[model samples]
Target: MGLKKYTNINNIQGKKGSQFSSQLRGINLERVLIVAIDAAKFYQKALLCNYYGDVLERPFFFGVNQDGLNLLCSKIEEARMEIQAERIFIGVESTAHYYEDIVYELGKRGYGVTIINPATTYEERASALNWSKTDDLDLYAIAHALIQNKGMENKLPEGAYRKLMKLTRARRSEVQKRALVRIQIRTLMDHIWRDYQGFVEIENNKPKKKLIFSDFWGKSSLFFMEHFPHPSSLIDLGEERVWEISKENKLRIKETHIQTLLYVARKSIIKSTEVVSAELLLLRLAIKDLKRLDENVGLLEKEIEKELLQTDGRLLLTVPGIGVVTAAEFYSELGDISHFDNAGQLIKKAGTNPIIIQSGGTQGFYGRISKQGNKHLRFMVYTVGKSLAQHNKDLRPYYERLKERGKHARKAFIALGNKFIKIAFSMLKNRKPYESKQPDYRIFTEVKKKLLYTKMNTYLNIALAA
Candidate 1:
């Protein structure tokens, strides 16, 4: 229930062969410096040597750029130059927004760079937080996490991944800018004209300032303001003039709207103003930015699909529920499947493993993921699992089976996703495509019969006792 109860899977008691093997084989990790950066804010911490659930050296203050990543590469380069020892592993958490700078530089330098989840480092720091948070202690926690998870198989992202990461980040930026500008546009509209509030129609329900044109073709909005232009100027001009304009616009207008346009134009008049030009400019720029981002996303998706069809890529993609994108992401991140000796390492990376809460005589579990591994990989798997559950008939039986055994729907879904992750890992390691495993329907039927029989027996026994 508290910090003391949090446990790490440091040891695997099971043996694979004649002798026992460590779940993780430790490197001389004390020579390592693990770096973690929070991308949303300008925060980064670096710990010296072997801290990923291991203890060797302490953590320290690391620097992030004013933009959270501008200076990241320089810091990595400096660390590599200074720590001219056995090895240097820089582990960074994937804080949603892409850390292309960090991943590219560290991976380029041949350092054991890992893109992990920030929650993992947070859990690691739980023990060390006596008072408050500091960059120094954070670096230590990250370093400790690296040590604890030594022999941690990091999934090295590929070229397509880089492209995906870059495109996704750009898309996020454009989306943010649009959000701000949209607010300003909405505020302006509400102030000038509140009659048409919520009447604006959007094709896909997406918000856009350009849709405001539906309220005023040109003169209508201008006519509303006393100092602006007037709709009445075009009124007495006759039906032919309005028809010519509608024809030019290709507008499908009914007779009633045509009449209203004529009447309103006759009734509405005002002076000309300059606000329309600026509004038009902002709208044009916003539309252009959104379109450009969409284009890049399309290109990135195509490349990822191409990479997915690579020989090894084909093997991964053939797995149930692991489609082109998922397979590509998995392949890119996990360069080699043989690196992981077992499924737990893979599961840990999936971030689906439950964290335990135990104290005194009571032992229980909390519904938090051990977010200490490949967060991106974990999310990918979870997403794939959901997709599979909806579409993959093969995984449906397994999911139903698990849910029937009293797992929470969301939890069971993730558990199912984790289950698929293991299967996918196997298919990758064996260089074989996924083949659906048919359910033993008879076996399930027999089990259900036995359960019913047992219930009957219990009921009879209670009757006799009564």
Candidate 2:
């Protein structure tokens, strides 16, 4: 309703001029804070500040730098003390790891904080019909989004979902760093060795830890490297030692394999023969580090699994294709499921929501996924759907159903993935575990959700007495 509808003024005491407050339920956001991050020294501010009849104060400016995090932490501390802040909302455009500490500082201090995606800000800016862009514009957009979107349904998220967000972001960072090191190892092995790929199959799945750590990379294949142990001494050692190591390693070699492994450890044209020794040392260390990261990633998966078991994941695993890991990812990121209103919302967020391509008058043909949701979750669903199509009897019929209707293989999988959405909705909404057709298994209950959320300690005695 527009603010204009509530015209007349009155107080319970029948005051002369006081207006009756007709504002709807929940806290009202009268004042807001926006923190924008940028690498440049100057940025244009473009905040058109009214939202839902609330006006934002002119934004105060601040700069972020290498050590700006310390200042941000102190600034938020000051804001908490400066105002009563009945409904203080803090918004920032999450850039790099800048938002990491900023969001952490503000959220850690107990303010209502939202680190908005750039898209959300752009959508809101479009609604305002403003085309200009600048740092100032962004700060205002952040404030506008906060006041307008706050107090809407589904605003509060479960605590666990936030934890999962942190974990995924941290994991991505580690994966990126590991790729850099692996590339260096690849370059070394390519230049310093000739038979490296043939022997180790590093080009295959990866420099697998099971293979690398077992004396396979150094001991089993060392003689096969382009610059073998000794170029001048291959004559003294003869072919016997090379043949013995090859057979013992079971490398599936013919007689030519030994010749290649023992080939002049130094070809006159070997480009970097001078650096071969040093390069080998670096490559070995890289393999060792890669092994450690592989183990760490596995440990993280197990931890996520343990926590998901406590939450509602049965709804996810009940589907034919989803396994423990996929189900854990679904529940962990999607939170309590009640946050979504229906199957459509779930599908849209899962990026399984189908999009229609229509022109001004003509109806267009089929289109692909909107692809506008949690990509990790969507990927998990797709993989599960693929597995189900291969091994699941129930899924086979659905796959055929789509194919008969002229859907492509990929389209068929998407159709099943869409159906998976409904199963998730039913499971999460009903607070039930997922079991297949038999329907006899009970997965788990949200223990806190039951018993009116009263503490199970001595507090229970007080409740009974009352």
Candidate 3:
């Protein structure tokens, strides 16, 4: 017989496409041993399998420490020798941070490691197996998933990008904390001054509503709260004394505001009692926490800005309405824009990709976004798009065009978000600044002319009828 050429089992197309077939692309399935680990905090369950997803060794238990890692490596070596395998692939679920150490150790020991999403393994278990869950079954599922290529290759940011991610996450945490503290402050104000919310001024024939204590936990507001602590105290102090206090504290307040504050203080239904003192104490403490959180957030922003300046993130700022924080967020989440082949992938990662619903022979209808990836990135992109739509030279017109085409305001913003991603992808990939060349304006001019003509014709007809 003539010599036959070797082919990967995954390359063969069967009557029904196998789920694992998609995963096996770009991977040589022949003469390869796949080890899948069901990782836990202290221990892990592992299964050794061949490229065909056939289990080679029964499930084994190993600790998460060095001893367990060594034993696991030894087992893999033995299996490789027995099967005469040229390659070994280790697949583990990216559950929390439990898999980090093992992944590091395995990579150091010269093994290819892939991180599988826990959701993927769960789906695999539900679809392929009829039996209840067990360590062995889970391990087998993970291995089979790898053979089918159901996981993404593990890639972590390093150097400046890593620093940027850390700083941005910290900033986001502090910002959220500040928001919570502001809410707590408002809740306390409700109890202390129930009628404070009704205080407003009529400006330009419209109600200009003011926040409680002038501004929420603002410097002057906090100082005033610290000194008076209650509306009754402000009432007792009177306008003159309160004005002197404001001067001493370097607070800028108009004479009318002082009079209004006294008026509200005297008319307030909530009186300060000994029991109310406790609420005041809590409110002051919450305000103090808010100040601390604000300081921390500011510091984190400075660090993030410094790190962003070192990267090509500055190019993102060339786009109108994209500031340092937004650029840093983009750079941190994306790491390198070159990893994505196109803007569509970037949009998908941001979870801004629209969903389509279809059944039977009915045409599909577009639904909301899938919201499958990084939520923070999605929010940042949406905010950036909103800002661009209002301010950016090119994007503003595009946004208006979408609205003119009968897209809802929110839907138009979503479209702008998608457009922003494409523009950002190109800008980052080319390492160039955004050029502010206006798009074709003739269409808008023609629309405007048509609308004006229609309006003038209506007015002329009305006049002739009269």
- Each model's C-alpha lDDT? 0.52, 0.52, 0.73
Tens-digit lDDT string for candidate 2 (179-290):
8866776677666554344443345668732222123344445334322433444444567875665678775556664565455343323544466768767766776786
TM-score of 1: 0.53
Indicate whether candidate 2 or candidate 3 has the larger lDDT.
3
Would you estimate the TM-scores of all the predictions?
0.53, 0.57, 0.77
Q: What's the residue-level lDDT of 118 in candidate 2?
A: 55
Instruction: Give the clashing residue pairs of candidate 2, or none.
Output: 44-136, 45-136, 45-137, 46-136, 46-137, 314-434
Q: After superposition, how far is residue 130 of candidate 1 from its true place, in Å?
A: 3.3
Better of 2 and 3 by TM-score: 3
Which parts of model 3 are misplaced by more than 4 Å? 1-30, 39-45, 57-64, 129-141, 197-214, 351-379, 390-393, 397-415, 438-466
Global local distance difference test of model 3? 0.73
Residue 48 displacement in candidate 2 (angstroms): 8.4
**Deviation of model 3 at 154, angstroms:** 2.9
Candidate 3 per-residue lDDT, tens place, 241-262, comes to 9999888878887778778778
Backbone clash count for every predicted candidate, in the order shown: 20, 6, 2
List the candidate 2 regions with Cα displacement exceeding 4 Å: 1-48, 52-56, 62-116, 123-135, 143-160, 168-187, 199-275, 314-323, 357-393, 396-415, 429-466
